[model samples]
Target: MTEHQDAQGQHAPTTPPAEPAVKSAGPSPEMLELAGRMFDAARTGDVDTLEAYIVAGLNPDLQNGKGDTFLTLAAYHDQPAVVEMLIRVGADVEKANDRGQRPLTCATFKGDAASMRLLLAAGADPDAGTPSARQTAQMFGGERVAAVLDEAR
Candidate 1:
């Protein structure tokens, strides 16, 4: 055991007490609720709420456990305005989810021409991700999307 001098010049043992093991409690209810609201805002095209959350320090590119970012959910849900808002707030256009699906690919898969155009205009990579936005458009027979992709390049 080690000893330390006290203010009165007396020596005292410096041994510390043992600490108890602690368990993690994961995210708080408030945090989960906020996350739910954020995801809801993205899927429902609630640009006002989404923008407010982002302005209040929520990440524009915030992703869920499935690796889907706010932009990804908005694009997949055909929410062009929400996608635009996320993009304007600095969300990544080419961020791929755990499934390797980018926002452009999600828009193309859903045959949402407006969202696809929005993503493309924001510099989304047409040839990125697993199937790639171009391949998804071709698979879905989105000739309009293919045309948009061609025009973007």
Candidate 2:
């Protein structure tokens, strides 16, 4: 089929998208994605993979989109081995997520007694962060977990 054209036989001019005025000084998207997977490893108890990354120089304190550190996710998900490995490597147990939820609080929220005990033994402050572990347990009816938190205080 024949198409009509301008009498001048000229194509329309278009401008390409403009680049940002300044270069980003943050980690590249690829690096961020890899870090996210490491956080997932912590949550899912992929101990071997997670340990390998940490040994390979991945920051043990890597935070997810919600600012949840390795310890927070591992404890919240009830991954005892992962939590122990993280504690051994010196990951901060007190780092709260964006919502101000700490690893201990997460454990209590999930009623994970094992993680609560582990975190408490590792020196996690039971009273840190908003809705502290004790408060979370009491608020959520985590009687058993509450008992563990009480012992830590």
Candidate 3:
């Protein structure tokens, strides 16, 4: 019997070596470009690029230099669907920009009923402000937003 053999035993089957786990690649220049693209897409309400980026794992609440998030830009531009999408993706609806204007307040000042409705439904505070949403709406003569303010009481 060979030294490799045990009593009445055939050669032991060798265990296969374990494979190491591979990690996903880190962010590259291309990813940075993709983030910038998503930010612009939100500004224009470009649904295709926005959806594509979201599906590809870009965060919906990404902000620009002015601290304006995607949702903020969508509200500012009166893009209701984009606003809804951002809200659905957990964007901070009440986040203030560099000017200290909330998304809802900006929507109110611009007199966008659709955006206002979306923001209100997302629990944005109509009465919460330095220049509050209610006051901004009143200043801009936004009857719909003013009505919203009244209902919040």
Candidate No. with top lDDT: 1
Residue pairs with backbone atoms closer than 3 Å in model 2 (clashes): none
Model 1, range 98-149, lDDT digits (tens) per residue?
A: 9999999998888788888888888888999998999988898467778878
lDDT of 3 by residue, 42-118 (tens): 87889777977777787766767787888878888888889888788777888888778888887888777788888
Residue pair clashes in candidate 1: none
All candidates: TM-score: 0.83, 0.81, 0.72
User: C-alpha displacement of 24 in model 2, angstroms?
Assistant: 2.9
Angstrom error of the Cα, residue 84, model 1: value is 0.9
Tell me which of candidates 1 and 3 scores higher on TM-score. 1
Model 1: what TM-score? 0.83
* Model 2 C-alpha lDDT per residue in residues 1-153, reported as the tens digit of each score: 234445698655555678899998899989988887888898899999999889889889888878889889998898989988988888998988999999999988988888888899999988889988878887994567778988886
Off by over 4 Å in 2: 1-22
Our tally of clashes for model 1 stands at 0
lDDT of model 3 at residue 99?
78
TM-score of 3: 0.72
Give stretches of model 3 more than 4 Å off.
1-32
